[model samples]
Target: MIIEIIGIFFLLLLSAFFSSSETAITRISDVKIYQWGESKNRKYIKAKELMNSRERVIGILLLGNNIVNILASALATSILIGLFGDKGIIYATLIMTTLIFIFSEVLPKTYAIRESEKLILYASPFIKIFIFILSPINFLVQNLVSSILNITNKETKNNDWKQNLRGAILLANNKGDVRKPDRIMLESILDLHEVKVSEIMTHRKNIEGINISENIDLIIDLALKSRFTRLPLWKDNADNIIGTLHVKDLLRARNTNTNLLINDIMQKPQFISENTSLSEQLNNFKKDTVQMAFVIDEYGDLQGLISLEDILEEIVGEIFDEFDKQIAGPEILSDKSVVVDGAMTIRDLNRSMDWKLPDEEASTIAGLVIDIAQKLPSINETIKIDKFHFTVLERQRTRITKINIKLIVID
Candidate 1:
């Protein structure tokens, strides 16, 4: 009886070892580990080439072998039962399951996850050897899987290795190894790849700039009062921004009674379209050594401007300087509508007040009215949008400019 029990114990131990081995292999195979570090790019390239082709096979084998080990445990219990009757079978089965569950599932998986990178590095040579030895079985399994995938429509030409890498990142995030801010920054950086320059630029109306014809005294006052260090100097209107002036230069010229022409103070301004990416913009800023770029439309009209600070703000949220002033929210009228600044961005308005404005030409409240009305509106000239009504409260230079707005129905 003692000998029989010992044999059963040995079989259980073997099964557990195989099970744990399967788990460890499954956990490590899909994980990527660069050979040495980033400095060893050549080694990483070789290691990657060696490991890429066999990952799916490794995963399949790990799952298949784990099942085999689990069944081995059950088979050993059955043999113990046959030889030693009900009580021995019960005891053997309980002991085998407990040992396998703890040693095979929990402990090994924990360690595999913790030392996954190191294990992948150290185990690469062995993994390659195993891949070669199991090539025949791997091919057979691959063919079977391919046939099954064909029936289920799951086969892929590309292997989607990139998604697997992202999944690993997601796994780390799910496991609480990555922090929220880090994840957000990663996502924001990725988003920069898809987003173009046009979406985030300031509009022409929002661009408060000085004309080049302005006097030095006015220019100095404007420079002194300005929040931005670099300001665009236009020829006649905002559309013809010839150059950008540095506030420091304006300060330097303060003692000189001599007239400072825009030409004299102007530095070459870089022009960028709305369609540029944030990443590309950063590169431009580095190359140009300038902090701001004028955003122009295809028609050469000044659309708005974007700054290094603006892009940085998008990444890290709003930044305020000593010159920055807090913007107040729109005044809510007694009639339930609100008086909103025409300069307020639609994005900001919608986010702040829970209003869904139409997403057409205008990003601002004033722009929206002009687009929809097709001309500047007169006082009491109302436009109904959904349940809300807009009444033109002010007009500045042929623009609806500002309005008294409210939602009257469907409250």
Candidate 2:
């Protein structure tokens, strides 16, 4: 009776070990396992192998756990039956079930989930040995399981890489491993493929350029006055952008001879469509060894300009240098009202103020107004959209310069 009781206890403990090991191994991340593998850690390498053949490991664990649990219950019943006769079976069932549920299932699993890394490291060797011993049974079980899944037409969907990456970033943030700004940056990088150059480009209206007709002295003066390193050189008008002139090239020319024409130093402008994805454009920038590109419409009309810095800013937030002018975003006038520049992109305003001003119809706040109003709004003309009021503060002919936005309360 003593030996039988000891054997029952051993089986129960083994059942708990299998249960906890299964839970811990499943919780360990593949990235951490891979890192350990790179360092040639034997336990992690074994863990990785088990993880790779997860179905087999899971099969072995379930088979071993169930077998031990059943044997423990049977042994306990036999011992109780010998002591208490017919009533011993009932007592044995009740006691064994309670013990297994609490000690074998809940307690071990809870600990395993809490300290998954350490549990995986310690449990891996035992798991590998069990896998080797149970290989034949595990293989048959896996085949049967696969056959059943195929018959039921149940297929497991692979996780989307983008969604996985985004989830990982959010998880890191929640764990306090990654700060909010860094999390946002990481998310932005994942979204680069979805973003387009037109969404972040400096609109043609805001572009500062030098006309090729201008003399070297005037061009030098324009370059000195402007904060930009690369300036577009147009032939007759801003619409006819011929090439991009770098300030460094201009300065180099001035040092050699004062009679340098814009054409002499201007590099050919690389033009990209408005619909080009930021990720693709970034690759193009690296492949072509160009820092700036002219964004164009379908008809080959110049829409705006996009630089490498603009694409990078999408991921790393704003990049400001000594030459960058402090262009402020929308100015908050009150709790409900604010003044915003006409050229301010709708996406920028929405992001800064946490507003849901739509950008699908138009890119900029001014353009959105024009798009919704179906015509150019006059100064002081107030347009109501939902609970928000848009009052044009200034207008440049068809273009809006400044506008006051008021969020109306629906009392």
Count of backbone collisions in candidate 1: 5
lDDT per residue as tens, model 2, 133-176: 88898789889998998899895756486886788988998999
Q: Residue 287, candidate 2: how far off, in angstroms?
A: 3.7
Give the residue spans of candidate 2 off by over 4 A: 77-90, 148-154, 321-411
Q: After superposition, how far is residue 254 of candidate 2 from its true place, in Å?
A: 2.5
Cα error of candidate 2 at position 366, Å = 5.5
**TM-score list, all predictions:** 0.63, 0.81
Residue pairs clashing in model 1 are: 197-274, 197-275, 197-276, 198-274, 337-406
lDDT of each residue in 52-95, candidate 1, tens digit only: 55456465446444555566566667777877888767877787
lDDT of each: 0.68, 0.86
Error of 1 at 366 (Å): 10
